[model samples]
Structure formats: C-alpha cells, structure tokens
Target chain A: MPKKSSSTKNLRSALRIDPEDGVVDLADYSPRKITTGPDSRKASLAALEDLGAELVDLQTRLYADGVAGEQRSVLLVLQGMDTSGKSGVIDHVVGLVGPEGTHIRAFKKPTEEERAHDFLWRIKRELPGPGMIGVFDRSHYEDVLVTVVHDQIDDAERLRRYRTINEFEAGLVAAGTTVIKCFLNISYDEQRERLLARLDDETKNWKFNVDDITERRMWPEYQKAYAEALAATSTEVAPWYAIPSDRKWYRNWAVGVLLRDTLRDLDPRYPKTDLDIPQLKRRLAPPN
Target chain B: MPKKSSSTKNLRSALRIDPEDGVVDLADYSPRKITTGPDSRKASLAALEDLGAELVDLQTRLYADGVAGEQRSVLLVLQGMDTSGKSGVIDHVVGLVGPEGTHIRAFKKPTEEERAHDFLWRIKRELPGPGMIGVFDRSHYEDVLVTVVHDQIDDAERLRRYRTINEFEAGLVAAGTTVIKCFLNISYDEQRERLLARLDDETKNWKFNVDDITERRMWPEYQKAYAEALAATSTEVAPWYAIPSDRKWYRNWAVGVLLRDTLRDLDPRYPKTDLDIPQLKRRLAPPN
Candidate 1:
C-alpha cells in the first residue's frame, strides 16, 4: 500500500497537480491545452489500468466478505449520451471486477412488458446483492432523456418520471447501495467525426445510422435534456459526475478514477477469522 | 484467426485429446486419476487464458459492430455455487474484451422491491444491446431454485415460473440475444472444505458464512432443484451446459471454451463500409 501511495504520488507530481486535488474543473480546463501526447497517453492508460486492477481487487475482497455474510451490495449507474463512452467505461472499469462479485446491466429500449410497468421496474431487479457490485449502462435515466428530447411522452409525464427516478435512486442509496452516476459529455464535433468515421470505415460502417445523424441535429434539445436531468437528479446520495469525454482515453481514465475513489470509500476488507490450525490440520490434511 | 486455431490445435494435442472428441463424461472420468502437478496446472491455466482472450477479442469485434448497428446483443448466463470458479471464468475470458462492449449482471437475493414484482421482471431491463455481450451471474433460474427448494411458492407456481423462464430465454434468443447458460458443478466435499478454509483463514473469514454451510446441508434439495432447472430450461434455443467444477482451474478452462465457442458462433465482424478517402478528406480537411 505504501508503494502504491508513493507511485501515485510520483504520477501526481508528473501531472503537476496536488495529490489531494479533487475534481479538476473541465469547464475551464481546456483538454486541448492538456496535450495528450504519447507520454501523456501512456501515463493515462497506465493510470486507468492501475485503477482498474485496484477496483477489481477491492471488489473481489468485498464480495468474499459479501457472500460470506450475505448482507451488503453496491450499485453503480452510468448515464451518458450515445458514444459518451458508457460502454467503454463498462468495458474498462467493471471489466476488472470478477464475475462472482460484479454484475452489469445495460438498459435499452423499453419492451411492451417494460412499458407496462414504471420505467424503474426493470432496473430495480438488477441491483447488486450484499457483497456484489451492479453496474447500469444507460440506466433508467433514459426515460427522462429520450422520452423528453424526442417528445415521446408529454412534459407533465416526463417531469413526473424525473421525480420518480430521483425517488428510486434515493431508495437505492437508503438501502446501503452506493450509487455512482456519471454523465459522459462529448463535444458535438467530436461525435460527428466519430459517427462519420464509423460511416466511412468498412469495419465501422455497421455503427453508422442515418437516424443517429438526424438525432445529432437535435443536439441542442438533447443537451437541454441532459442539463435538466443532471439538475433534477444529482442528489447527495447519487450525484452525477459529468466526465469530459471528447478524448476516449480521458473518458476511460476519469471513470476509472471515480470508480476507484468510490470503492476505496467503500473500504472493503477481508472478513476477520480466528484460525484453528490444529483442528484444520486434522480436517484438511491428507491421510499419512 | 488461423494462428489462434492452430495454437488451439497445439493445445489440444498437448492435452492429448482427439480433435473430434466432444465434452467428456465427468462421472466416468475418475478424479483420482487426474494429477494436479505444477505442469498440468500451468497448462490448464494457460489454455483457459488463451481461450478467454480469444473470446474477449471475438466479443469485442461483435460489440463494435453492435454499437454501430444498435440492433444485436449477446446474453451470457453463468450459474454456479459458491467457490465454483465463476469469477475465474469471467476473469480469464472477459479480461481481453475492450472496455466498450460488454456488460455483466449478478443476481442476488430479491430486495423488498424486487420481491414485489415477477421474478423475471428485473432481468428484462438488463438485456444487452445488439452487438454487446451481457453476462448474468445467477440469473432468473433462482426463481425456480430458491423458491422451489424453500417452498416459497407452490409447485404450480414453480412450474409456471420455470416455463416463464424458458419462454423468456427463448424470447431473448428470438430477439437476436444468444443465450449460453453454464452451470458449475462442484462436489459437496470440496464445497465443505472451501467453506471451512474461508472460515479458518482470517483473510478469508469475511467470505465464510454460517448460512453457506446451512445451504450446503440443503445440498440434496439444491441438486434436485438444479436437475429440474436443467431439464426444464435446457432447450435448442438456449441449452444449459454443466461444467465439471470440482477443480477451479478446469472450471475456468471449460467455461472459457464454452464462451469461445459461443462468440465464434456469433461471428462478429467489423461493419463493412465504402470509404472514399477523397470524400473523407474533403469532409475533414482544414479549409485552406
């Protein structure tokens, strides 16, 4: 642990930031000026990898205790725009967690059955158990976003849904679930470039949709919806951390850090035991 | 891909198994005859890791396309008892998938809210998007196992729920969701030893639950529950594979093989595109 702390200290020094620095304000901090050259990219990737490994190790330790006690669980919710890299965050961060301890749910369009229930109906089922971590990619907030932006639901209904979501998340937090909400913010130009790249590349062509481009034209509406969503739902229990995601690498790094911070705050440790070596030798030791 | 195949062939050769040989009957294969020498352990771990990496790469390719298309997804369900090495399987296999294309959901005991809904209700929301892979650890099958064995519901309800689960799985299959269910079968003696070790070791004490031992005592009931679950749910659309899990290393290897087979069958490829370089350049090139 000392070695880890020292290494982090060195890396923080290299970043020329205080080791105790909280959120770096992206509003004023120009990522372009941050200069993600080869060295920086390598460092960022390494940091992500480090954070990922730590998160997994911590979660595993927590699960071992969790399954033993069968008493506690954590739920992490990731809310981001299309290609805000929600999938990437899942791919990178939870990727490190062992399957025994970690579970992820990626919510999509509502089915007829789902439509019959409240928007939160499907999500509540996927919550993590005691000693488990559950991740939601494009979670219940979609009801607030897509429904609002596309005018699929009336404004009154949408507002009611927002309150419902807030209440739902509040319930989860009250139940001892640590809810971490992240909003990935990618610049419109960057999104267009990525979408076009997908369109142009043979291997990426499947990702391009004319409908997505049409949706891109509604960026202002989507932005307004996002701002409102964040404003309405970012509570003390489940605050929204808006990640600057123009650079894919940075998105990965930021999410990893946030996860690490959250899990460390969890302080999961191996459950204590009183070993009886003599008794165990009689039970587990092979017959001579 | 050819290199991977040939290497897998070499691996098969080293294991001295016929290429056409299907999964062996574990009951007929004596455990005493199997030596757990260092060489064998290394070989098994290496093979599992190789297979896991291949599956990750394959899933990643599928996911990239899925993200582009937004229409296809893969649902992987892994069911096992404690210490059945589900984590080992996921750790090795998904370790290689890029951070953008995979999701995992681990089902725990129902919350107060979850218990209020139908068993499968929460699961429906967590389905993977097209091109993404969703892994469920101890999924809706629990509705049958826990409820049936505990007599929490009547036999008629259990049967109905079983049918409901099968139908739900089949629906997922029809909806472009490939369902691969894996059951890890470890012997009772091994489970007891593992649990005792968890209890004995201070580092692992948190994982030792008096309830796990209680559950272990209900082994016969659970076994019957599993057998019934397997019989009822294993279908052409989504069949269940029982992996011999007395050995953690072998369990990981077997699940990795199954995942590899499933992903390979999915055959995710990069979306095709006609990228006119001139057009791309005209779109992105700076205005002189």
Candidate 2:
C-alpha cells in the first residue's frame, strides 16, 4: 500500500478504542449473558430507557441548535459482515435522534449510474446537509471490502482505490464533516446462527439470502480486506470503531453511547431570540 | 390583490377547482374528503402498511438508479399545521413506499446556518437525490403560512414570498426534481376538538403550548395564506393537492391513492440479474 498522509495516520491512531472502553463496551463484551450488576433486568431496562431518553434530549438540542444555525453535521458510516445487524443498529441507535434531524441512506448494489461513476461518487452525493446527521447502512466501504474480498477488482487497483477512499474521507473531514465509522464485529458462529434463525422464520425470509453466507465463505478474504481498509482509511478526521455485535442489546447501547459522546463533543448551542411576550400579549389582548 | 398570471388565469379558468375564478379563495374550496365509505377504514389500514413498504422499495430503487446515472428524483413534501396529522400522513404514505426505497426528511426549524440563508436554502440542501424519494414535513411553505399567520413578516414580504416560492418550485421541476406538495386541511371544529383531546392527555402536554392556540386564532390568515400559496405555486411541474385530514383513516387512504398513483407513474423496474444457484451453492458449501 502507498504511504498515507500525516492526517490519515493520526485518525487511524486515535480510533484504537480499548476492548472494554465504557459501560457500552462492557455491556457488549460478553454476548450470551448480560451483566446487569446490581440493577435487575427491569432496572436495566429502565436505565437503558433513561439513557435513550437522555440521548434523545441531547440529540434534539443538537438538532435544534444546528437548525438555529450551528449546522454541525455528523455522518455515521456502519460497515460490517453479513448478519452483523447494520439495519438493527440503525433502527436502535438513530431511534434517539428524532426523524427531523437524522437522515438515513442505505446503500445497496451499485446502480448503472453508480457503477458508471467512481465508487465513492454515490456515497458522497448522499452526504447530509450541515446540522443534519446522516447514517449509511452500508457505504462506499463496500468498494474496498465486499468488492475486494470477492476479487471483483485486481489487487493493484484495490490498493489504489483504498488510497482514493482514504483521501476522500480526509476531504470530507476537512470540510467540517464528522465521520464516525463503526464496524459491527460479530463472531462467525454467531453470524451463522442469526442467518439460520432468519431462515427458520417465515416472516424473515425476505431478509435471508443464501448468498450472504456464500459471501461469508470468503471470510478470511473479507477480514483481510476490512483490516487493510480500516488501516488505510481510519484517519484522525474519521476513525473506525469496531463494536462487538454478538449481543444486539449491548450493540445498540454502545452505538447510542458513542453517538451521545460525539454529539456532546460538538456542543451545539441553541440560538437566542428576544421575544417580548409580555408586551406582545398587551398589544394582542387588552387587560380586563 | 395583484392580477393572476396568464398561466394561473388559464388553469383556474379551465378548471373549476375553486368557487371563485378570479380571486384565490380558501373558503371556496376545501380539501377533498375521504369518507370512511364502507371498507375505507379497513382498506386504509392495509394500504398504510403497503404504503411504507412501497416507499422503502421506491426510495431504495431511486437511490440505486440515481447512482447508476438516472436523472430521476422524487420529492414528496408533506405540509400541514399542528394536529393536521402530518406524522400520520407520513406513517401512512411512507408505509406504502417500503422502508428500502424511501428517504424521509422531516424539517422542523431552521438551523443557524439555514436561517442565515433564505428559507428555501436549507430546503434546497435537503432535496432528494436522484432515484430516491425525499419526504419533507413542514417544508418551505412554512415561510409563507406560519410566518404570515404568526406575523413573523409583513404583508409585502409575504406576497413577495408567494412568487419566489412559485419560481423556486418551478426551478426544482425544471431541474428534473418531481415535487409533489400535499397540504393537509383540517376544519376548525376538528382542530379545536383535537387540541382539547391533546390537553386531556398528560403525556401530550409537552406538545401543547398555550400560544399554539393563539396561532390557531389566526385561522383565517393561515387559510388565506395557504390558498394564495397553493394558487401561486401550483404548476404543471409541481401541483399542490389538498387532502382532508379530519379522519385518520380517510387521510391515509387518500394519501395512499396519491402515492400509489405517483409511484405507478414512475414505474420502477428491478435490476436485471441472474441468480446462479451453482455459484451460490459452491460458495456456501466449500470444497472438501
């Protein structure tokens, strides 16, 4: 791979979050058993709800402030292997941000036009406006991960594309875009189980494609691709945080916590207005 | 009042939508009512689910197609006052469009940057990308309706805004953006009753402001603004349809009919691809 810029190198270094970082990581570190501690399951549920409510309030304030003109935009890119719960992640994490400020764009197969343009072209076009939070279910990372793993592109070309992606993300960050890239890291066994469960449920048949597991067969290739891609592109401007996704509830909490922290860092302030309600009231309504 | 445009004059003269031909009048014509005639309620419930699903499908296809090089984009702007059931309209309408293909952007207040720019500036930034459908809640029309009714701006500014909005909408259409503007019209009695109901519910108190009713006091102003706004802005490119919003069931059904018809007109086709079972099988079942 070509040498990365100083900025890209810095981003890559900052995002190396520990295996157990906070309540979020702790909640998710173990999959089968939830460590609620002193809090009962009911209390845990309430706590999560409370966390969710706080997150919503913070996000709402950020949104209102942005609308009032702070206009700080955060673009969250979720990349993971099949059955990694990208959709579920979005449904739960973004559930905190009211629909008014959050914009979700899920990328599927490249259209004829998308195929025509550079891989990043389509994703770039869908970037959220200032003050809005855009969430991508799967993003341009697919170019480096899926396509590279499947040997859709030659190795030389894949390396060049990786550099291009690194540059592209750097440009986005330079332009005041906060890019939060998250990888839903689930064990292969857990993934197989989830896929099987989906297959078992008739209601979920629409979601299960046998091709997903077929892609999983290229597991090593994909893992290598993800490792290289993250190594190449996770810059100080846009870092990739790998979230343990075996536990769906914990995964949701982790994403929510990350979102809360990120928004808090932005510190969006509401716009001030001098509305003299008392005088206006006197003018509009005569006192008895 | 200024004289109507040649095109507006022609449309009004040719079509008997309003009682008054020359002057734009809200009293003359109300939104088309969706009477719960027989199976309407049941049909609406079924259709609401279909609406969301279809929207998702359409939105997904549109996004993909646009990235592929298609110039097609659809903007479904949902405009209504408080309790006009804008949320319900979105729930029912977007439900028709499956979650896959649709991108819903609910515009609340202007961000600081958005306010710095003109009213339509933020709106312009949020326009749907090609191949996907963008839904707006309380769009730029708020500049005219809310601002005017709430005395945010003067009469001259309000009239100037009408023409500017008309041109703005026309420009969007000319740029290959299909703008479908729908206004949910609920009656005074119905609105008052809804407000009373909201007051009765402790959970809903947060949504209610004493001044919200004060805005309602300017009902005639809002009605007049909407009438002129629609008349001035409605064009061959982007027409405004008034949907009766008193009955939730009827609102859903009417919205369903409109969306179903619009999507049918677009007639999105699935990508042509052959599923090779052998390839899938080989990938799923690795060689021994």
Best prediction by DockQ: 1
The superposed Cα distance between candidate 1 and the true structure at residue B238, in angstroms, equals 6.4
Q: Cα RMSD to native, each candidate?
A: 7.4, 10.0
B1-288: candidate 1 lDDT, tens digit per residue: 001123432322222211113233324322223322222568878776566567666876887676656466777787767777665666666545544556666677888989899888789867887777787778898888888878998989888987888788888888788887877777777876777676566676665545565576687888778766776776768876665567776666655666676677777787555455466545544356
Give one digit per residue, the lDDT tens place, for model 1 in A154-184.
8889779878888887887787788777777
Q: How accurate is candidate 1 locally (lDDT)?
A: 0.66
Give the C-alpha interface root-mean-square deviation per candidate: 4.4, 7.1
DockQ of each: 0.34, 0.11
lDDT, model 2, position B256: 65
The parts of candidate 2 lying over 4 Å away from their true place are: A1-47, A152-160, A274-288, B1-25, B28-76, B80-102, B106-134, B138-181, B186-288
Candidate 2's error at B282, in angstroms? 11
CAPRI tier of model 1? acceptable
TM-score of 1: 0.72
Q: What is the C-alpha lDDT of each candidate?
A: 0.66, 0.66
Task: Show the lowest summed lDDT stretch of 10 residues, model 1 chain A.
Answer: A11-20
